[model samples]
Target: MATKVTEMNEVKSSGIPGLDTLLSGGFSQGRVILVLGEPGTGKTIFISQFLYGGTTQGNENSMFIGMNEPKSRFMIEMSGVGMDFDALERNGKFSYVDATEVRRIPEQAKVGRIHVGGRELGLVNLIDMMQEGMAKVTPKRIAVDSISDLVFRFPTIEERRPVILDIIESLQTTGATCLLTSEVLSTGEERTVQPEEYLAEGVILLRRLPRKGMRSVQVLKMRGQKVDTTPRPYTITDKGIEVYASEEIY
Candidate 1:
C-alpha cells in the first residue's frame, strides 16, 4: 500500500483541537478553504473560530469580508461565540469589509456586462474593492461569509463563476489563508455543485442531519488533509463549535 506523504510546511491551527488532528496538523498556508453548510449548521461559527484562532493563537492578522450581514451585526454574532471582535480589532489583528453594495455594469456589451440583481458592478469594480480592502488591512488570513449570497446577486451562474475565481486568485496573491462559507441546498434534494468548490484548495462541509428527533453537526470533507471521515457530533456553545473527541468515528 502506498503511504501518504506529509508535507513539511508549518501547520496552521484551526483553533478547534479535534479538527486540527484531522487536518494532518493544520491547513496548508495560503490556500483557499470552502466551508459549506445548511442554515444553523454553525458555518459562521466555524469561520469566526478560524479567524479568532488565527488572531489569538496563530498571531496572524485576519480580515472578514461580509456579504449578507453588516459589519456590526457580524461582530455581534461573533461576540455570541465568545470571540471579541472589537478587542481583536483594537489589538490591530483583525478587520472587516462590507461588500453588500455590489451593482451591475450596464455600460458593457451584453456578453461582457456583469449583472447582479439587475444591476451589475463590472468585475473591475469588484476586484478593485477587494484590492482596496487588502491594501488597508494586509491580512494574513481572510474569510468571506457566504459566497452563495454573491452568486445569487449575479443574475446568471456564468457571470458569477469568473468573479468567484477572480476573488480566489486575488486572495492567493496576498498570501493569506482564506476561508469562504457557502450555503448548501435543503437536505434530501441533490445539491448542485458551486464552481467555487473546484477553485478552492480545500473544502470543509458542515451539515445538520435529522436523527432520532435531534439534529447533529457533521464534517463532510477536508481535502488534501487527513481528517476524521466519521460523523463527529458537535455543538455551538458560547465559545463556538466544539467537536467531541469521544464521538469521533475516525
Candidate 2:
C-alpha cells in the first residue's frame, strides 16, 4: 500500500487506510473533494476520520464546519467512533464552526463565527466563515459535514450552484485539501450534474443498494490522475468508515 511519496509531493495521505490505496497514496494535497451520498451512507463518518486522523498527528491541524447539525451534536457523534473531538479543540489543533447556530442567530454569527469578512452574518455567510476558519487554522485538511442544509436554504439550484462554487474556490486559496459532503437522490445511474460534483477536483460516492442493504463506495471522478472506479463495499463500525479497496463488490 506504499507509494513513492517523494515523487508525488502533491499527494497526501487521506488517513482512511483502504481508500488511500485507491487514491494512489491519497488525493491531491490542496484540491477540493466532494463526498456525495444519501442518508446513512457514511459521508459524515468518512470526513470525520479525515479530520480526526490528521489532528492527532501533532503538527497537523484540521477544522470541521458543521452546516447541518449543531457543534455539540458533531462532538457527540464523532466521539462515538473513538475520536476525541473536544480535546483536539481544547488543544487548539482543531477548530469547529457551527453554521447551524449561525442560522438561528444571524447577527451574532460574525462577531466570532469566523467569516471571511463582516460584522454581520446570515444563512449565506458560511462560505465566508469557512474561509476565515481555514486562515486561522492553516489546516492541512478541512471538512464540511454536509452541504444539504445549505442547498435547502438557497431555494433553487441556480442560487445553490454559484454559492457552492464560491465556497469550493475559496477553500482552494487556503491551501488545504477539503471535503464537502452532499446528499444524493438515490435514483441510481441517471443523474444530473450537481454544482458540487461539477466543480470539485474529485467526487467519492457512497450508495446503499436496495438489495441486501449493501453499502459501496465509488470514485466517480478524480481529475488529472487514474483511479480505481470500481464499486467497493464499505463498513461503518465503532472504528469508523473503511473501504475494501482491493475487494470486489458482490
Candidate 3:
C-alpha cells in the first residue's frame, strides 16, 4: 500500500468497520472501487458484504453481476455465510445478473425473462445486457462479483482495454456506487496490478500471506477519498470479511 491523499464530503459505509476507517469513512459516493486479490483472498466475500450491507443496513437496492459462477450456486454459498439474497430479492431490494451464464446459454438466459428491459440481447455484446439490467434495476449500488475474468476474456491489453473502459463507463451512467473485483497474486513487497486497477476510481487490494496464514487488506488508490495506506489485516468468518483497520499482522 502507498499513501496518497484526497478529500471528500459524503461517503457510504463499506459495512466492514476497519475498512471504512482506512477509506476515511467508506467509499466516496458513486465511486468505482476495485477489489483486487488472488483466489480465496475473500474478494467475493468482500463484495457480498458491500451489497448485503447496502440492502440491509443502508436500505438501498443493489445489483450483483457475477461472471465466474452460477447465480443459484453463488446465492446458496453466500447463504451459508449469512447473506440471504433470496430474501432480499423477494422483497425487490436486490437483483442479480449472471454474466457467465448469458454467454453459455443465451437462449436460456433471456433478457425478458430476467426483466432486463424486456428485450433481446446477444452474448457477444455483454455491455448491452448489463445496461438493460442496470436500467431495469436502477439500483443505488452495483457490484460485478469478479470482472477479473475479463483479464482473461480479452487476453491482450489491446483487446481488453476498450471492453474494460466500456463497462466502467456504462456503470458510471447508472449513478450507483460500484464495487468491482479482480484476481491478483501478491509476493513479499510487490504485486501484479490488473488492468481494472488503472480504470477504477479506487483499488482495494487483498492478499493472503502463506507463511503467516493470514489475509490483509489495503487501499491502493482512492481517487476522491483520503486513503490510509497502512496494511490492515482481515479475516473471512461466517459473516464475511472483517477488516481490522489499524491492526498489524505477522
TM, every model: 0.81, 0.85, 0.84
Candidate 2 lDDT by residue in tens digits, 1-250: 8866643258767878599878877778777899999888888889988887776853579999887788889888888877888998888888988777555643333455564322123434776678778777778889987776655556677877876777777788777778999898654778766777888889999988877868888898888767889998888888888889999887
Model 3 over residues 1-250: C-alpha lDDT tens digits? 9755443335889877567889878887677788887788888878888989988999988888888787898898899778999998899888888787544432334445463321123224566657766776678888887765545555577766776787788788777888988777454575566677799898888888775768888888999568898777887888777888778877
lDDT of 1 by residue, 40-60 (tens): 788888888888888899888
The runs of at least 3 residues in candidate 1 whose Cα sits more than 4 Å from the true structure, single-residue gaps closed, are 1-8, 103-123, 154-159, 212-223, 245-250
lDDT score for residue 233 of model 2: 86
* CA RMSD of all predictions: 4.6, 5.0, 6.2
Q: Which stretches of candidate 2 lie over 4 Å from their true place?
A: 1-9, 102-124
Better of 1 and 2 by lDDT: 2
Model 3, runs deviating above 4 Å:
1-9, 102-124, 185-188
**Model 2 Cα displacement at 95 (Å)?**
0.7
Q: Model 2 — TM-score against the truth?
A: 0.85
Clashes (N, CA, C under 3 Å) per candidate: 7, 2, 0
TM-score of model 3 relative to the true fold? 0.84
